[model samples]
Target: MENEVNTAGRPGSFRFIHAADLHIDSPLRGLSRYAGAPVERLRNATRRALENLVDLALAERVQFVLLAGDLYDRDWPDFHTGLFFREQMVRLGRADIAVFIVQGNHDAQGTITRELPLPAHVKVFSSRSAETVHLAALGVAIHGRSFPQREVPEDFVPQYPDALPGQFNIGMLHTSLTGAAGHDTYAPTDIATLKTRGYDYWALGHVHARAVECESPRVVFPGNLQGRHANETGPKGCELVTQSGGQMEARFVPLDVVRWHQLTVALDGVESLAQATQTISVALAEAVVGAGDRLHALRVHLTGRTPLHTTEAQQPGTLEAAVHAAAQDVAGAELWIEQVHLQLASPIDRARLAQGDDAVAELLRLVDELAADPAALVAWSSKACGDVLHKLPAEAKAETDWSDLQALRELLADAEATLLARLGGAV
Candidate 1:
């Protein structure tokens, strides 16, 4: 029940829950690679998380719940999933809280939800076209539509109704809004379009990070009810929107039952293994706290320069094991440490490596040359590497000097050594 109140207002203030990106029935990947850590725990955790959202709504006595989209993970083959969803909807209905949902790219037309009969309290907006639902009794009007196809290339905002007069109008949509990293640019719409629509509040979905795009005429993302992967880090849940006299405000409420975590431990200028381990311990503790109520998975990234870099190069698994052991020792912690990625650099004497008859130096030189040619670098992976490379933060993709290249090359060699000698003899 981590309530992230972002707005200043009184209680019982026309409250409703704005939640989205419930990728329900999504496969819980990469959790508990080690024994005694059951994946079922994580699967049930997501369901429990949804229940927690309902509980939150009931506790707050919200007037309604706005599920912008992605309620299911595409079409579930079995009815059990749909049944589970029905039960959740019934719970909300029992609380007399209405639920409004639209279809996302994942659950477009012809999906399982199309056939499932939701509770009377649940309102699934039509994919055939945009529509508005006016709750005159509540003095609220909601405008939205569902994804008609799996991919939407045009702006869907134009399909939304212009704000109704004298009503607290909210537009519920599952759109990329503007383009977002690591996601398809579906239902593309801009802030200006939403603003121009004259809607008092925009309950948006499809991106899994909670954000307040604007305050006045409020455009907000409630993020996801649960974090499904490593890329989705930190607090996740719905927004609590409260309105008064056609004016609106919103707050974040974290409802994640389990969290995905990544901790980057920088090791610049470190002296010893003890020092590095100590730093890693502090970082692990910090990651757990940052995960809020439910952080079950973790990936530790060891970055920067240090004496431990050499030690990690020689026997990386020992260091990884120690870190895992440390995380495991935390009481009642479901922390599953998957891997300790080495992004570190040893003190490099570049001229010495390059000048001498060192095989490592030659490898370093080649990698440096390859890294220099942006065109050649793009050929390594099948993805839109150029697009991805261009999108990287300037600081990460910044040009490097010979010494930096030497460090990067060594880092690559060290990674191979770590995988082969320390992680396993597989690489």
Candidate 2:
């Protein structure tokens, strides 16, 4: 319903919703440590997003809905999760909107063995082998296979049947597709292999980020229905696709209830911490306005070199309190400060300081050397910190990869900032 409709090519047409990675009831990861986090709202986001999906299907009068994978986070502790899913399926059933699903790693046979009597309108593909379901009325053939276990190292595309000559053949897969940034490899296969597989379209899952791999015979990942954490930021939603003749039109519909955002306020040449608070307040107001109507969970990172780093010591908790206060009056929209990262630095010209012969310059040079070389930084970390990464809390370590070169560089910059803040008084 979002994009411009294309009706020029041919009269033959149909509309369907494509969504994936509905990690229902999965708590927003790494938010528990933060005080006053929107734990409840985000925890229920997936369910609400699913409700939005069903509502869209009914409202648009789509032929069918495709839930590519990861319908559940894991094996449900109780029957509530299963019941909620079935209730939505029943809603779709009453409206005659069919749903096709393939279980991803989280809801695989071995991972989530729990059983439920889903509505007849909902057809979950086989886990043991590739299964094809024919929607004779719509002339659509959907082929897919669920994950038998938690991890699938092999390719399932090779096993999928060839495209039917007269029908629109769609391949539903839960794959990492050779690999993705944060996810492990599952159902690994190349794009070339998928293109040659003879499917009209590919609806892929497992990767939370949306990607359209091909256009000729459309291939896509609709991303997750909702954002479960800070890492999965921005507008989270599904693809509303309309296929007519040889042309396909796809529109991304944002269905997320609580949108995750990372806002950075550079202190720069601000006179005082209180002055920066005014800036922070204005930024929060603008961010809320920009986010439209839905709730925004913000992780604010205040960065920049400023004399306010030393000034911050005058009023210990002023910055943190100001951040929370800014979100209090968001007019019509609602917002929550998930966490405040004070990644600020003292107003020191380090490049000039490094030109000196003092102890400070020597220290600055050593920091520079480590910052420039990734291997040196790792070696310094190993010898100096004694398994520093392992010592950190699991949640904290999961947020950052200390070993990666770029990540290490960022980490060094952060550490350097902290040191500058500490020595600001002396300077």
Candidate 3:
């Protein structure tokens, strides 16, 4: 619990919670993107995470909660999901913590969530135009706008009130703000424009990475409360905002229930299965350091060329089982080994394989070459299969892999580690 000061030079703190990208019904993307992960937990983690956020708001004694946008995934299965969301809102309302939100592209008018009756304390900004909600009691004025139909490329910040008289003006927005990586450029607004709006704090959304973009008048992305995939690593949560004596301060609070996990173990010249399995076990333990004692689920990626690859490739199922067994060895462990990606290669020299005339070798070479090509690489992915034709009841089948984000991140980390270790002579 830290003191929050407003810019007006007032005394005593006004505490509030800032959260965004709840995506209430977001289908756990990565867990089911393949097989082996705890499917039920993955599917339901979003709901649990939202509950966690509610708990956080109450614990922090926040007078209000700001939901920047995308409260639920568009067209969430049925009314039950919406009902569950309302239940959490009810808890916040009981605590007298009002919530303010704006719609994002995910839950636009065309989606199924357009009919939910949010709690009385929750206020959704007008989608047709910018509006302001003056909280005179708290000496705060919140200004914001929502997406009318979904696709809004125009900057929406310009429409916000320049500044409110005798109140801590907060601008709540759901935007891609100046083009964010891994996010669509929706409702783009420049940093300078947002700064000039004269709001004491600018709460932003659409990017899963938590950031403090500015300090003079704090602009922040609280990030998603839950991690949906391995790409969204590290702590995830909402930002707690409080203003005291006219100074406003915001702090990030972690709230993820079932964390999306990533564990990488490199094999340089290992040849024995026992040695490799032991190394993997140690790596998994290290990664789970701060995860606490929970029903942990992991996505393990076995990288770097190793002599174990030939055996690992021939019996993928066996390797997967072995890793699961190792994870299960931990006491009271409910850990599930989701998938073990074998990016390993044999210690045997590539020149030997190229020189050989084995038909399997030649086919492997051709397949590898195709995998290296940009267009061809995408065509070979499962996403491409769904894109080439129509599949009923799964409209999102055409979603582009765009970049194999997890793979790219792992590759880059490996490259950096190699260069650093070599340059410093520490390898």
**TM-scores of all candidate predictions against the true structure:** 0.81, 0.84, 0.81
Deviation in Å, model 1, residue 48 alpha carbon = 2.0
Q: Which stretches of candidate 2 lie over 4 Å from their true place?
A: 1-12, 29-32, 244-247, 313-316, 351-425
lDDT of 2 by residue, 266-368 (tens): 8888876567778888888877676678889888988888776655554556677878876774567788888787777767777888788986677778888
Backbone N/Cα/C clashes per model: 0, 0, 11
lDDT of 1 by residue, 1-427 (tens): 3333333221224789888888777876434444555577667766777888999999999999998888788678778777888899998999899999898888777655447778888998998888999888877888889988788898888877888776778898888877888778999988888888887788899888887787766788888888876778877888876665434556677888878788888889887766666777777777786555565677788778665656766765666766776675565456777557777665656456656565655655655666675554434322424566567666555542323544444444564344333533221
Candidate 2 worst ten-residue window by lDDT: 1-10
lDDT of 3 by residue, 114-223 (tens): 47778778998988888999887788888988888778899988878788766788898889988888999899988899988887788888899888787767888988
TM-score comparison, 1 vs 2, better candidate: 2
Give me the displacement of residue 82 in model 2, in angstroms.
0.8
lDDT, each prediction: 0.73, 0.82, 0.73
392, model 2: CA deviation in Å?
11
The parts of candidate 1 lying over 4 Å away from their true place are 1-13, 30-38, 245-247, 269-271, 290-292, 329-334, 357-412, 415-427
